[model samples]
Target: MTSFGRISIMACLLALLVACGGSGGGDRATGVEPGPTPPGGPVAPPEPDLPQASPTPYAEAEALFPFITAVDIPDDGRPLVDFQLSDAANTAITDLSSADVRFIIARLAPVPEGNLTGNWQSYINRIEQPGVGPGTESRLQATTESNGVFTNNGDGTYRYQFATSITDLPQDILAQANSEGLDLAYQPELTHRVAIQFSNGREPANPDYDWVPASGATENIFRRDIAATPNCNRCHDQLALHGGGRVEINYCVTCHNPGSTDANSGNSVDMKVMIHKIHRGADLPSVQAGGEYVIYGFRDSKHDYSDVNYPQDIRRCVNCHAGTATGADRDDLVLTAQGDNWAQYPSIAACGSCHDDLDFSRHAGGQEDNSRCASCHAEDGRAGSIQDSHRIAFEEAREAFKAEVISVENSSPGEQATVSFRVSNPLTGEDYDLANDPVWQQSNSSLNVRVAWDTRDYHNTGNNADNASSIAANALTSALPRGDGSYSVTMPLPIPDASVGPGIPASGSGVAVIEGHPAVAIDDGGSPASIPVGDAHAFFSIDEPDGLPVPRRQAVEINKCLACHGSLVLHGNNRADNIDNCVSCHNPRNTDRETRSIARTPPTDGKQEETLDFKHIVHGIHAASIREQPLQLVGFRGFTTYVYDEQTVHYPGRLDNCLACHTDDGFSLPLAAGVLATTIDTGDDHRDPRDDTVVTAMSSACSGCHDDAVARAHMSSNGGNFATTQQAVDNGDVVEQCAVCHGEGRSQDVSVVHRVRELP
Candidate 1:
């Protein structure tokens, strides 16, 4: 997710601007049924009263496009990156964390009027920073850090000291170098000649910019190539391309034109089909049924994807597009069309419902010339040419473990120290079967180590604990649960230890934090399954030996602890006297809502007797009227008065708790044994324990606001619309559509939440 420039000048300007168009209007297919509206869609009409500076509508200059240009990775192994920004060059990039930049155009001339050169096409290719990846030893210059600071060493091979102008570059590169024939007409002109070359050859060749003969020690920062806003090819042609390939439209600029790239795969088919069609439209369902398939976003805004899921009945091309796709696989590119066999038609019906043990109807030897899918993903068995089969396959398990951070073991109450490390899980012998994976379906290869300590700076120190009970007894170490497999747990120090009963600190030390979760590779939202890895923490620290004494450790990064624990009412510190271990799972099982109890079965639409448990006087009278209201009632997805931050995406809104479940304990005693009450209050002075109360005997008669004949037979439990027997208990009725289906746990009657107390 980082990028700035140079991948053969962004793959020959993304295949010569993929054939430019979208001067802002005209390509409307907004989906979800609005199909017929885009020719001028999102509401189009005001072109007549123009004149006064008539040059805005490239769809209103693409709606003022402030920012959202992501393309990040770009070292030789191209994927595309050129993102632009203009403010007449004041260049105030706002944020994608520090504006991010990089360069290397070399020579691209066209300035006809004032002072422009022509017929040049050079580019040399060698700036390297958007997200580092090529070999490693040549060190002309390098530096990295984010949030903690020190960003942009000129884009890795050096060249981003910031500041630039030349009209801000983007008008689809004069229509992508006039479809590669270099046409630069219109009120047009160009120079883009950058070359900062550094590894200390004292700023190598700068005939105003052209350095690419490296040896180390980098610097080059001169930038140019501006002029966009002609509705920048209407939303960068609906982003998410190069990968899923195809759909920045216009047959994707004929073949990604402008002195194009893809020389048998240096990559440029308009940036590898827009990054493989935006990671395969992040796994569609028409973009996850409106939730937009996701990985995240920023090329112009709105795309978070709330954790992409999509998997209700398989689809997603053998992970990287047939011919078996495996050369290790992690994705950089893998499909190979042109003559179309995609391993025999619809890729074997999208992998026959989960590899149905692969028979593809006898390998379709009946048609669709699959060529036997290269016998198993072409490593060397042949079927190559998707540019020799899309490269990247977990690079030796991604360079087998080298992660660092080797020490930080603070602890003192007079003194005590012991923190350890050693972890590995390379797997080469292949005796596999960790339950065929869903992250071990539910733990078996279970290797977890999460120790967090700082015991709030060793509480009252002096070796801590002295009968002073409760803060968890001085707190230091207690969440230990090791499984058998790859085992290890030294546990033996604590200059202080001993809390859950007297002064809480559990151990005699100040800092004993150690972490490790490892298990990577996972992909089961459903079907053509994938599970290369999972879990991974790895953080390290362990000093306290050279003559004893090192009490202060620090590592942070649970995404900065979700910015204040994802807030909402002391954020779940909701009592057993404040966070009683979050009532295990937010209360509900015993009896609260003033000892609630009710029922009356019979009515399976027998026209009477219905009334189920009414959840503790209806969630304790709407949670005591929203804790006596004054504005604190947010719940339902508003997550109680919201608050998020995520660096500044902000939220601060929402509320709603209602003891989570009319809880004095929870789930109100199996709904008082499936209710059948008329008036039952067996007294203890109404359960007096400082007045515990339960009231009943008809709370004020009239059967407490009627409904005596069982809430109209449980609201006609479906029999009212009858179609009957499709099964999970009726499967008949209709007319309920609470927003078409309930939220989250989505259930429109698959046993209506398990037939709520079925005595009917």
Candidate 2:
């Protein structure tokens, strides 16, 4: 008997013994009295010992699933094949019968030109189903029925005896390949794809049921390795489709290989053609030229991807293909088979997949034979190499404009301040005079050389008012050309008088910024390319006895943004790349009113007050998808309005990934005490006649994203107000006591509020 059976018997015997009063005291069946104790007061009854059940075997403790280990096909005349199966632990699974495993073998044959009807490249193993047309010729080659006898080896393996050999394939399949100029008799050249589905009646209880099905094909037989799913998942989260049953790339390639097509749409579904077109989406030359790229699948459902954007430059081949990684050799990019002419060899079909330019053939010396493509497009070749050709020229010359401020002195209200600065090529360590170079002079005309002044006490409070007051030094008027590598400039300061207001200080602290376009250029193998780059600042006191410089708070770092954007260039031609320079212009007092007035579609209220505060704008732009309205910003020079539609500004990843951009715990909470006030334009005449409201720093920053009615109401319930209360006093203007609960180290901090455990 089995151990389980023995345990059951023991249980029944114990119950019967208890019913019969077998404890050596009383006869319960006859109702007899128990024995009496005579010595030392009272006697204690002896305890009965029960039999213990045996432990279960390790193998039987949990259910086991079958896994295909190996497949063997002999060259002998006997038509037979062998398969090996094992458990998860590699233990032999010798108990499964022939009915436990199912197999399908397919020959990867080339589709003939005559058979290239409908979406032939996307055809899978679907054979006749309802509205869908008859599947492609490839499906007919591999039937769903089984025609072999299984012989169990009794040692965890099975041998299947077929009734035919390779030569015994249906005459129709051989005829089709022959029409396509393929020789099926050449066994070594033909690719065979195999699929196996296994079940041991235990899959119902397992969570990973789909994984029980396995599929694989002859590798390196006819195709090149292009993209991997893991790399795609870096942004796609997970590449799942068709109800997610098909997840592995290996399985996808078997059906998505050559000879597959969608009969309903008449489009080729080859991996290269489909993936390129899918990612290119609305950008495809055909789609752009008034053609629709659509695919029909499943129950004749049409999937049109004419509006999908690839997010990044499609020319970045390395972004998807593993073979494009640094230091990869030529063999990594080349196809393995010679017979698969369309893609198995370097051809225009592959190159033009994404480029969509028919003129490439003309550019490649009009050569019909693509064998010489590697001569100029080799991986590590010279100038015309694929890698060198795609290199961005501007990125290669970025260091030429790197500049720094040496010092700033004699900075006082209505006084000419002397500024000294130097510029150099970071790549070559060569110094260049900014005031004399012809290229520098031409571009420097648009450059801004300015100094910003603010109280030292406010700067120490972590406030962003370091640039509260600024004065520009006209390059043509104030700059003195020094023959040396450095240059000097004198500019009049525009600090406000102390008697102007209650919060305004006369001579407590000050800062000066000497920044402008260095106008450096580099030859990009063609014309000279110029980019904006130069920034320098200094801290000092106007009239205080002792002055100590207080550094500004370091929040977001430029390197973090570079991780995704490659290069964070903004404001026409790279002037706003630096964080310090960005904050200088996008401060509290700045607004988009000037540009809004001339906007193509100005606000109907006849008043526009959009704050340019850095914190508020950044949060609003990132969270634009969740906002109820569009995010519109006006340009500083062109008086142009830039509107960021929610659909177009999709963030690549989850917004809760704070560390993806922030450096320190800077996103923690309660903003700096000295942050400047912000004016909010309600755009509704019914709410307020002025339609302009001034809010505190923290309130403006949070409301930028949480502009919902409920959020606004909750904020208003607290001390948060949209309009300024007291204009002159430091913390008394907006009266938003946000630090009471949402302050750093508080119960409900900013981090706690924005903390996202999982993407919803």
Candidate 3:
């Protein structure tokens, strides 16, 4: 569903490059000096000397960092535990004193199945509203404040010895648990888990381990890999939560079990239920049925997720709950652990969390027990299987059928372009005569081929120079098929003159695009029939009819877009999944003139027409939430609402990581020297190809997201041009000097500033 928003703009404008500072010249303790001492001032005191202890020397390292390697609680009845820590550093480790780092430990016990979590936190020392059901844990556990102090060996590791022994909980914690009427017995024989959370101020690392005290085993029967941290970082940059308390999912699940609940709202904060409800925020049946999902946290702060609209379809469970690994060789799979919990297991608490409107009270077996729920909800059950229920029609159709563009020919300037393509069942390895397919002949089914010129940049001079022809299924069937399972259709290049020898269209390359969906009975009794027609594009040249044509630059790929947004069926399903197909109409010169036509919808929208320049539109739309002046762009026939939903927009990852979309460091500065400036909406100009006002290429892209006066002023000072005629830019009179400061290898390089994983 997210066509342009997935590839959001990283606000890497010139001003920000200064914010991602350069190499430091001072030690970690004393920051770089502002200036030399005043020569005329009285000499500063240097007399007092204090006694120093023989400090524990830190082990050699190449860059002090946080990485806990091991955590163990000796089961020999000693009130002691030990954990090892390793770190990275560009220089020998020196600054990591006991004062520079902190550590905490949590002791957990594995419980029986039917319990929401495999393990429960025995380390959480306090509980709130704990009479019955679920209650929140205060988590004021075995920290230095509780006298469960750790001894820093100063050799890049710390061995934390609790004040209480492994044989029992602290007296106070025990008293509190007993007063709360809890059953937290000291079960040393059961699987015991120790989680160590460490931080070095700059970075954090959490390491957890499982062991059976009685057997001295390092593995656990209760371990589960329902989901891992890496899966979350795909969207959340580093996945740190609770101010770094729950740094990893392993640590998070310890307390966010079925035992946890938000007392204020009476809603379960179980990880299984909370995560689903949070992600399905606005779409939660209970929410739509006029209820709010709120969780009162630390200090009783209200966290409302009612406006949390997930960027993709929530039905795509695999987005987060990828099924268990297929290979038997995987370590996590071999364990008797829960991996792929989303699909393999079905729970009333988990399932009902999202589908809250399903009143299981009236159902035959009710919600008390989930033992029999799998009989009908298993992957291969008789009906309402988890996989079947969450099936995406588009993904299914995509797997069953394929639409591919084979080639584009006779693509010279001023000449009509011919396209040869295929429509077939990819699963069966058989081709379908488009004209003969009953699905294609049915209502809401058709194919459209568009031919655009000058692939180097689609301006081809005046505007969005592309011509499209909607071919009826029967019309294609009527055409003679080529010997190779393909059919060809010819359409005008619409380059103002198609026959002028070696004209604009004949220069770089001509892009041929085809897109459309067929009405199928695949979902006959399901919801609306699944209509999926994956679009494709190919470049061709008539200038050298037999030559391997030069194609347009591939900045963004459909596959990359699919990483975050599983599929993009835009504008009534006409524009399928190809990002390249988008540029055909959303070229540098394109705008939303047609949609804003006084004839289309109410209010005549706005005074100006927004430019549909690919990069500008992508940046403007995605970064709209942060801009002082939000972008307004209604699509064809107002396919999508133009009103920027600023209030509800939430970007989950670090905005600086441009690699989420950009390829080959394309997001770096010094863009192609003569790149075309994009037309912007200003002063009521609605020209098809606005000749009056335009924003210089780099300015258009950078300013699209940082659309504020101060940032614009900064961009303006750096040779960024805005609200100028295209001739002013095309005449070589305007040039951007961005690379001087923000290029690939400069001091404040764009790549350096935007890198999410590397040290700044």
Separate clash counts for every candidate: 107, 16, 9
Candidate 1 per-residue lDDT, tens place, 1-760, comes to 0000100000111122221111111221111211222111222212232123322211112111222122221232121222322222222222221312222232334322112112223232111111222222211111111111112212111112112121233354444444445433311123233321111111111112222222211234222111111112211212223221222221222223233432211222232233333333434334444533222111211233222222111222333233323222523223232112332222332233223234555653542433454454444544544333433332233233221212333433323332333233455422223334333344222322222232222222212222111112111122222242222333333433343222334232223222222244532363322222222222222232453433322211222112112111122111111122121112111121121121111112222111111222222222221222111112222222211112111111111211211233222111222111221221232211111212121121112222234522332342221111112122222332221332224454222332222110
Highest lDDT model number: 3
Q: Which stretches of candidate 3 lie over 4 Å from their true place?
A: 1-79, 89-119, 129-147, 163-182, 244-246, 323-337, 379-384, 460-480, 493-495, 498-506, 526-530, 542-546, 599-607, 681-690, 756-760
Each model's lDDT: 0.24, 0.47, 0.56
| Cα TM-score per model | 0.21, 0.60, 0.81
Model 3, residue pairs in steric clash: 62-89, 62-90, 63-88, 63-89, 63-90, 414-497, 414-498, 414-499, 415-498
lDDT (Cα, tens digit) per residue for candidate 2, span 374-471: 56665554425565656665655555666666666665443455777666778778766545666566633344465544532121111222222245
Q: Whose lDDT is higher: candidate 2's or candidate 3's?
A: 3
RMSD per prediction, one decimal?
Answer: 27.7, 18.7, 9.3
The C-alpha stretches of model 1 lying farther than 4 A from their native spots are: 1-19, 23-250, 253-255, 259-334, 338-449, 452-487, 490-760
Lowest lDDT 10-mer window, candidate 1?
1-10
